[model samples]
Target: MAASDVTVGVIFLAQIFVGSLGNSSLLLHFLVLDFTGGRVRHTDLILKHLTVANLLTLLCRGVPQTVAALGMKVFLSDLECKLLFYVHRVGRSVSIGSTCLLSSFQAITISPGDSRWAALKEKALRYMCSSTRLNWILYGLLNVMFPVVMTGNWSHRNITCLKDFGYCSAARHDTTTDSLFAALLSFPDAVCVGLMLWSSSSMVYILHRHKQRMQHVHKVRSPKSSPEPPKPSSSW
Candidate 1:
């Protein structure tokens, strides 16, 4: 194998190792907390989902890429390819959605009582579980086309409309169909990312305002310095 191939394999291995380790640690921590009867917060639940998603994504994408980079010609069967791609897509979507949910929840949590999001603060915790479940279901249903479209690399013979995916290939649709599919797959992700950006910005603004208010309160409550009386005697 070329040096470049070796380097790519090494990089993939490192990413898989680090990502798996970190996500596993987080998963274990949450599991321990649950088993020990520790108080589980809404964020903790979201974090657990995020970690699991991360682990799934890492294993599915990273392992396959690593194998390919290592010059391994082992091609996945059609079913295997479909399952792997489907799961990977689901995991990726869930991960992004969970992150957005967490951000929005936190933003609501820190909003002022008079803010528009104040009402949501109370409901956020209650809905987190359902929201996560719905997120999974939505993505799972959205990526259902993978199984139908994906095939093993060995099956790519005489196929003019095939999109190669290293270990597997997918049947290519016409331009209009492809565009529609792309839009469907991207719409949810775009919304999640937009929400994340909004939440992050709101949090930063809220924190800044809070800090300014604190400074103002401190200034108001702080004792004024007494006049320096001793210096007058020296002047005399």
Candidate 2:
């Protein structure tokens, strides 16, 4: 039987529709801009690719399962099942990893390191799309096989794939293959989580310091800076 936790299911499904639509529209705008056959073109390509990935995520994961939840798991062949679930799984995983990589890359790019990438930061704004060619190619290929690799775990194992294509929540399978997939799955999540947390903390710290500096400036400029000399004269 196809089922999901009621309240949780409703909220998540809603999120899928809302978020996907908004992103798709933004992607369309970029597409309409006529990405010139340069680095600019690659930016559009990557963004368009991301949209397709998200669309695949919604189609292969969200819509089908939501329909199933409303009725039954119809229109599913064993092959379709594998491919559908595989596409959802891989596309989502790649999305997460890519986002993490993007954030970390930004942090590093802006870092004090005198590395080559840091030097390119000033020029990045002009050709933001061009810089991502290598990034898109490498990561795009790295995760291309994820869906294929996911098939083994989906069928021969008990790993439960989520409807939102966010992540899989599954019971343990007494098989090496399943375990291996789980490990592969967990590594990126762990690294992404750790890096995000660390990055967030640093950002928070910087903001706090900035706040203190502003407060110090205010203190220095305030009229109270020159403590009134006890109102010595007056009518007292």
Candidate 3:
């Protein structure tokens, strides 16, 4: 292998090592909390989901790339390629959707007591699981057709084995299928982005108002700190 390829391999390995360790540690911590404390916070639950997603992503992408970088020629059959690609895509979608859910949940949790969202606060945990289930279902359906587009044929002259698995192509050049796939992938991500931004802004506004209220209370309760009139020097 060339020096550049060795360097790339090292980097990929480092990424996999650090990422896997971090996600594992986080998931372990959350599991401990759940077992010892006998309850899991909404935030903790969301974090657990995110950690799982990250681990999946790291495994799906990093392992293959790292192995390839090491100059080991690995070939995947069509079935393996399709399954791997599907898992990677689903993991990415779940990560994004989970993040959006976390943000929106926090926003609702912190909303004014009189607001309509406050009523749903008690049910948020239940909703979290439901939303996650829905996330899986939605992404699973969205990518159901993914395997049809991917191929592991190595005979095609246009297909080159430059990267890790050269035999597997993610999609063919069919315009209609490509367009539909693009739309399916982009739609959920767009929704996630929109929800994140909206919830983030609401949380910011709530925090700002809370800070102002605290400052006002502090000012009212604080005793006067005016300096005493300067006394004549004792050594005069």
lDDT of 3 by residue, 134-217 (tens): 877887788777666665544233644222254356545567966876887898899999999999999999999999999999
Segments in model 1 whose C-alpha atoms lie over 4 Å from true places: 230-236
Most TM-score-accurate candidate: 1
Question: Using lDDT as the measure, which candidate wins?
Answer: 1
Better of 2 and 3 by lDDT: 3
Model 1 lDDT per residue over 1-236, tens place: 99998998999999999999999998999999999999887699889999999999999888987998888755687778889988999999999999999999899999999988888877887888899899899999998998888888877656779987677788998999999999999999999999999999999999999999999999999999999776544553
Sort all candidates by TM-score, best to worst: 1, 3, 2
Local lDDT at 79 for model 2:
61
**Can you give the lDDT of residue 21 in candidate 2?**
85
lDDT, candidate 3, equals 0.80
Pairs that collide, model 2: 39-130
- Per model, state how many residue pairs clash: 0, 1, 0
Q: Rate the local accuracy (lDDT) of all candidates.
A: 0.90, 0.58, 0.80
Q: Give the winner by lDDT: 1 or 3.
A: 1
